[model samples]
Target chain A: MKFLHTSDWHLGRQFHNVSLLDDQKVVLNQITAYLQDNKVDAVVIAGDIYDRSVPPTAAIELMNQFVETVCGELGVPIILIPGNHDGAERLGFASKQMKGAGLHILSNFADMVTPVIISSDIGPVAFYGMPYNDPELVRHHFKQSVSSHDDAHKLLCDEIKTHFNAEHKNVLISHCFVDGAIESESERPLSIGGSDRVSHEHFVDFDYVALGHLHQPQKKGEEYIRYSGSLMKYSFSEQHQKKGMTLVEFDEQGFRSATHIDLVAPHQMRIIEGELDTIIEQGKTDPNNEDYLLVRLMDKHAILNPMDKLRAVYPNVLHLEKPGMLIGMEQEMASAKLARSETDMFRDFFLEAQNSELSEEQDKAISDIIKQLSQQ
Target chain B: MKFLHTSDWHLGRQFHNVSLLDDQKVVLNQITAYLQDNKVDAVVIAGDIYDRSVPPTAAIELMNQFVETVCGELGVPIILIPGNHDGAERLGFASKQMKGAGLHILSNFADMVTPVIISSDIGPVAFYGMPYNDPELVRHHFKQSVSSHDDAHKLLCDEIKTHFNAEHKNVLISHCFVDGAIESESERPLSIGGSDRVSHEHFVDFDYVALGHLHQPQKKGEEYIRYSGSLMKYSFSEQHQKKGMTLVEFDEQGFRSATHIDLVAPHQMRIIEGELDTIIEQGKTDPNNEDYLLVRLMDKHAILNPMDKLRAVYPNVLHLEKPGMLIGMEQEMASAKLARSETDMFRDFFLEAQNSELSEEQDKAISDIIKQLSQQ
Candidate 1:
């Protein structure tokens, strides 16, 4: 059985407050093309189908279009699970009826104990989907003493294992923060610190575990456990990470090989740092000039209308910063805060404002004014 | 072709600030039972499936369940359209894909020109659905001079007539205000006055025009042009209106009989009027005491704690009004305004307050105080 594994589409996501629907459309179209060319039998979307619980209408429409094109137009079965970002009940609506169209959205944990079995050339592949479950809900549902995400996942997985058939290949799809997995700023924290992280040892029994909630495409200790990552770079921290889908091929033997297919983004996210004049000159001749940019100016003096000037050259420049000003301001703020008295702080403010210390006569006048105000 | 026609479901509607989801479930369950017992060929929902463009999550879930029961469980085709309260584009999303499951939702003006042909025992019944189109959108889509909803509907119907087939029975399902149709407060006015009213003559080409937007089950000029009304009473004004679904039986020959199937509401809406004491006394023994009540007190004097007392006997009392207070207050306000000067008004207020004319000593004291206040 051959299947395409992907997750965290975040369809209605905004990059630097700009709507990424158009960009998402371009990348999703690319995935559809790949699906057609590869002739993949099925698709597994681990989770995080939307950027927020109540996504924008445009995002809903875009998702509907994508699902229609993939499952309806291409005739490929799609198994989807709700992520931490989705409103599970809302996304789960009409899911039972949608199964006839080959679009399976698994959201409820109680109904998810049974796997959605699909027949393949070799045998049947049982796809077990686990929607993002809060520890409290999991604990109550299973009547277990699970206090953390790791505990909940372990309990749920163990229960699911009981229903597993030894004769067929079993694939588990879930959205969880696996321990030791690389993190990115774009992915929302499932819990504080690493309490939500589930160790890869829990999933050793499964043939393959397609995971989400980590925006880096990499294997976690084992080749069978992987994160397909986000379809596009969602933050500056993710600029170095390669974004793509993971394709896994399986047979009757239960284990199989997995391959990563890189997706081409319409615009690359780049960080460029230099003096204002030099950066502007570079932008004029740079081959990737149209890429969404975060420019860091190293010049000592503050540049006037910096964003305006940078945008004139790099239209897609999303952010501008002066590292020198940031560092200098941080030091100044610390020293200014260290001033013990209001008078001393005022003196420092005067010196900073006028580029000179307060004169003796001026200080006397300020003291007299303070005395008058205090007397009233 | 026999079909169950219903409209103005307003599934997420609230009555007197109270959610009607539980009540809606009861009525919908009744409809489901009717479908099961009668074994209807199909169901036609004219429009207004949701109370608002963006309905609450529970409403979405209810609508999903209803569709699943009818289309998936019962294996019946359902034709739906968008109402004025609905966001047409959002509701229309995935409509093309939904058709495969026998759930057809027509929302766009451009895409709805062609009829959705369904095979029947007699022959084929061409069902044309016209979603609620604003006058501006209608004019732009067809490039016609439509200033009012009436003009828009006329132009659109004329266009639809061009595609009509004489051999098949043509049924037009639309969410529109037909002229001469009685209305209830629950129905939102499409436009000010009667500008939105489209004459029944426009839909003469169709064998039957199942209409919506008027929350009253009545015919407009002709027997074939009718409004099925809402599934439940959404307002006090609709309490007297019979709420039900319309059952129509048709064939290739065209004109057929239509019957109204009354729905039993979980809680009937009632208006009780009389003196507060008398109303409360009556409520104690009334068989319909549990019904949603709108109390109109006819007491000549002010009654304290009327709502609290009434609620003890009738828990569902939603509104309380003293008609006598309103009349007396309006008369007093008009007379009070006749006192042009502040002093004169104060003098009249004193007379009303004290139930006596001012004495010379009091008048002298009032003048002294007014003079001192004016000086300040």
Candidate 2:
């Protein structure tokens, strides 16, 4: 049985303030082409089809169109799981009804392991989908004293192994930040608060483990365990890495070789340093002319609507910086301890420009927030 | 054709700041009893199943249970129309799929005249469901150079007559507020500012016009046209009126008699007149002991924790109130007016409470709203 393995579409995502929708479209179109040529059995999206938990209508529409094209037009079964970025309950809404149309969406973690068995020529192929599970839920399901991510994940893997039989081919799909994997510097981690991360040991027993939630595409262990990577290079850190999905073919003899396919980023994001006028002129005649460009002006003074002028030639110009970037400004202010209390600083900056002045009671609330931030 | 004509359930209605859910349940149970005894061929609801477009989850669940009991459990075909109170777009959702389960929901104005034909032992009955039409939409639909409520309604009635053959046994269900009909003070009018009022003449052609929207059960022009009223007396104004639904039964010859099935208000809402201290003292031995009750204190001064005290004896007390009820609050502050302006007020109130002063630009925006209000 053959299937196209792809994940982390992140439909409405902005890469460092630049909309990656066009680049994403380019890669998806290539996947569609590949599917048509190869006559694949199924398309598996591990997780994170959207950037936010509550995706915009446009993003939902885009996903609908893609699913319609693959499942409805091409007649391939599409299986999906919800990732950390997705709201599981929302994604899981009416999933049972949607299954009649052959679009399988698994978001419920109530079942320790729910497998969608596909009847193939060789035998029934059990495609197991596990969404990103919270430890509390895992503990409730297992009814044991599991606390941390590692303990819960190990228990989950052990339970999955118990469900497995040697006769049927079993494939595992998951979304978690795996340890000992290469990290893309520009890729933002799923959670800044440590609880979201799960150890890679959970996927050890599966015949073929398809993983997601990491932008950099690479195999976790031998080739059997893999990260299909993001459809497109989302950031400058991923500029050097080849971006695309992995096509996997599995037979009754355990697993077959997986192939990685590369795709060109539709409009490469580039940063150019110069005066505002020169930067705008350079933006107008750049080789990657249609690309979303971020200009960092070396001039001391801020340019008036530099984005507006640059967009006359390059409509996708996302960001403009005068002299120093926001990160640079933060670094400069790093030595100023307390800084008139963090809330007072915010009240003095963003709100002050909007003609906002806090009352004594409001100031107290703001100061409380500052104290919390200081503790963090 | 044996058919039960009921409308305007308003499942989650609050009357004079009191919940009417228990009252609604009592009425529904009565209707269920009537349906079983009468052995009704079909059930027709003329719209407004909920008071608010986005009803509370409990309201939705209750409505679903009612549908299950009537349609699924009792094996009766149910036909529903969208009312002025309902979000037509939301009601129309999954309607296509729901048709297979014998529950028909009509939401669009496009199906204005086409009768939903249902077969029965007598003959074929054409059930025409006309949703409340705004004058602007009616004008747009017919491409007529008319604006008045009378004119738009005349156009709709013409469309109905033109399409419908009076030769067949026909039942018309409508949700509209018309002139020359007595209205309860609590009834929400279909339109506030610009909508034209529909004339009562529209029902002249039909054998029986099952009217909705007006909570008070009343007849106009003859016994043939009637308002089913609400399942319960939804407001203080409706307290004196006998609240229930009307069941219309048609014979082989066509014209038949209509009977009113009285539904007991589940929990009695009594305006107990006395001093607050007297009522509190009387509560010790006052052994009427109904599960749900609404106590009204005659004391001029506001009673602190009145709900808590009243709830101690009457655990199911929906609301507690002072003697003087705010009159015309529903009519004066129309939903559309409140919906648009309430957000602005909330935002301004928040900023002001924070001691945030508005700039000239912000002040101008606020002034513009004040100007609009002054002009109105």
Candidate 3:
């Protein structure tokens, strides 16, 4: 059985008040075409289907059309789980009824082991859909008298392993930030206020783990756990990284290595520094590269109607940043070059702040501030 | 085919912050029991299954239990449509997939004619589900130049008739306020900041129209258009109305008259007007009724902690209105009684004001105020 792994579509996302509908449509069309061409059996949308819980009508319609086209016209099965960004209950509505069309939606903890059995020539393959976990829900689910970051995840792994069969190939779908996965600039880190993290080792029992939440397509370790990354580069930090989906094949032996399908989206984010007129002239010469254009002007004086001028030459000119970014980049590079021993740096900072005397309370406050800053 | 017609469950509805879950549970349980005893083939929930678009998980669980109990356990086909208050696209998510479990959710105008053919012992009965109509949606659905409220509704009726079969007992379910149905305070009226009503005659084609939106159990004229009413009295204006669901039986000849199963929930909504102390004493005698009490205090002075006193006697006390309601009620009654002709009253009043010899500007201002008051 061949499966297409993708997640964090965020269909109705808005970047700086500009609607991503057009770009999203382009990417979605590409994905649909890819699925049809590749003859993918099942598509796994891990989570974060919509940017917000309360999506607009347009988002809903787009989702409906996509689902209809995939399941109705193309005859592909879809297994979707809800992310932290979605309303689980809303997503799970009429799920029991929708099973006939081969679209499986799992949004609750109770439905973790209820796999959609897909029959292949080898045997029956189980596709498990697990939604994003909240620590509070995890605690309540197990009814365990414990308070720790790893407690819930450990329990979830234990409970999930009970339903697994060593005889058949078990593929688990999840939306979680495992320890040590690379994060994109636009990717929201799972836990900001608390040190809540699930060890990547917990997923070792399953033959394959199709993961979401991390927006950078990368492997974790020697294990079969991987993140498919986001559909498109949502931020500048992801500009240097490759964005795409994963194709996993499974047989009687177990799970096989996945192939990363590179996404050729309309826009390729770029950062350039030059005068407005010069950049415009350069963009005009590259007429075929009209899909994406980023112009950064180096001029000290403001250019009137810069957006209008750039757009006149390139309709897809998405970003415009001043040469101030270059100054910031140079400063960052200089800081990175400077090296100081941790102990010496702290002693020098303390001596400078206290002059001749340093109180215990003041020292403790400084240490606390340093600890907070380091965490950020 | 015997089908039970019901709507406006409003599962998570709270009457002024008072949880109606208990009442809803009782009503829903009774409905399940009625279905079992009567041996109904199908159940039609016209619209407004949930009070809000994004209902809580508890509400979702309750809905799941109900669907599982009615359709999953009993094997009765339960059909649903979205009402004005519901998010149609959200409710309709993966609806086509769920058809295997005999649960149908219709949330779009495009699928209005696509009836579910239920093969009962008698024959194949076509059940059509039409969601609540928005004028804008109606215009878009028909793809024509619709100018007025009547035109929009007429187009929908016309479309429905094109698919309507006279030979079979065609049952139609809708969520719209008909012209002559009794209005209840429990209902959120069609408040588009003005009056825009669909004529009652548009629903004449169907053998039965299981209507919703208006939370009043009633029949307009002698035809088969009926409102099953809300499961519980959501407001004081509905205190006089009986709350229940309608069970209808259809045969080869046509539709048969159905019986309304009266539902008495654990709590009953009451409006009691008295002094705080007296009402508290009354509540003590009937402590069980206190939980469902809607006390309207008419004390001369403001009563501090009146709710605390009332709750001590009646735990289910929902509302505590200050003395102003009594005054307002009296003013309403007095205005109703004073039915003098506006023209005659204005002439006599004007003659008396002329005796005072006010300035022309003042007369004009007074006349304007009088005119506005008369219109009201």
Task: Provide the overall lDDT of each model, using Cα atoms, as 2-decimal numbers.
Answer: 0.86, 0.72, 0.77
**DockQ of candidate 1 against the true complex:** 0.42
TM-score of each: 0.87, 0.64, 0.82
In terms of lDDT, the poorest run of 10 residues in model 3 chain B is B189-198
Using lDDT as the measure, what is the rank order of every candidate, best first?
1, 3, 2
Could you tell me the lDDT of residue A110 within candidate 3?
72
Point out the higher-scoring one by TM-score: 1 or 3.
1
lDDT of 2 by residue, A1-376 (tens): 7877888788878766656676677677887888788877788888888877666555665676676677767878888888877766555543443454567787766433677777776677777888877778779976988876667677777877778877888888888777778776644565566655566667766778888888778887667888898777666546567877888888778678799878667776566667767766776677777765666767654456777777887787667666654545565567565456667577777575778777788788878888888799
List the candidates ranked by DockQ, beginning with the highest. Answer: 1, 3, 2
Candidate 1 vs candidate 3, DockQ winner: 1
Model 1, span B169-215: residue lDDT tens: 88899999887777787778888978888888898888899898888
Candidate 3 chain A minimal-lDDT segment of 10 residues: A337-346
lDDT of 2: 0.72
Which structure among the candidates has the greatest TM-score? 1
Q: On a 0 to 100 scale, what is the lDDT of residue A289 in model 2?
A: 71
Chain A agreement with the truth for model 2, given as TM-score: 0.76
Q: Compose the digit string of candidate 3's lDDT tens values, residues B216-287.
A: 888875447888887778887677789888888777766778778788777777788888778777766774
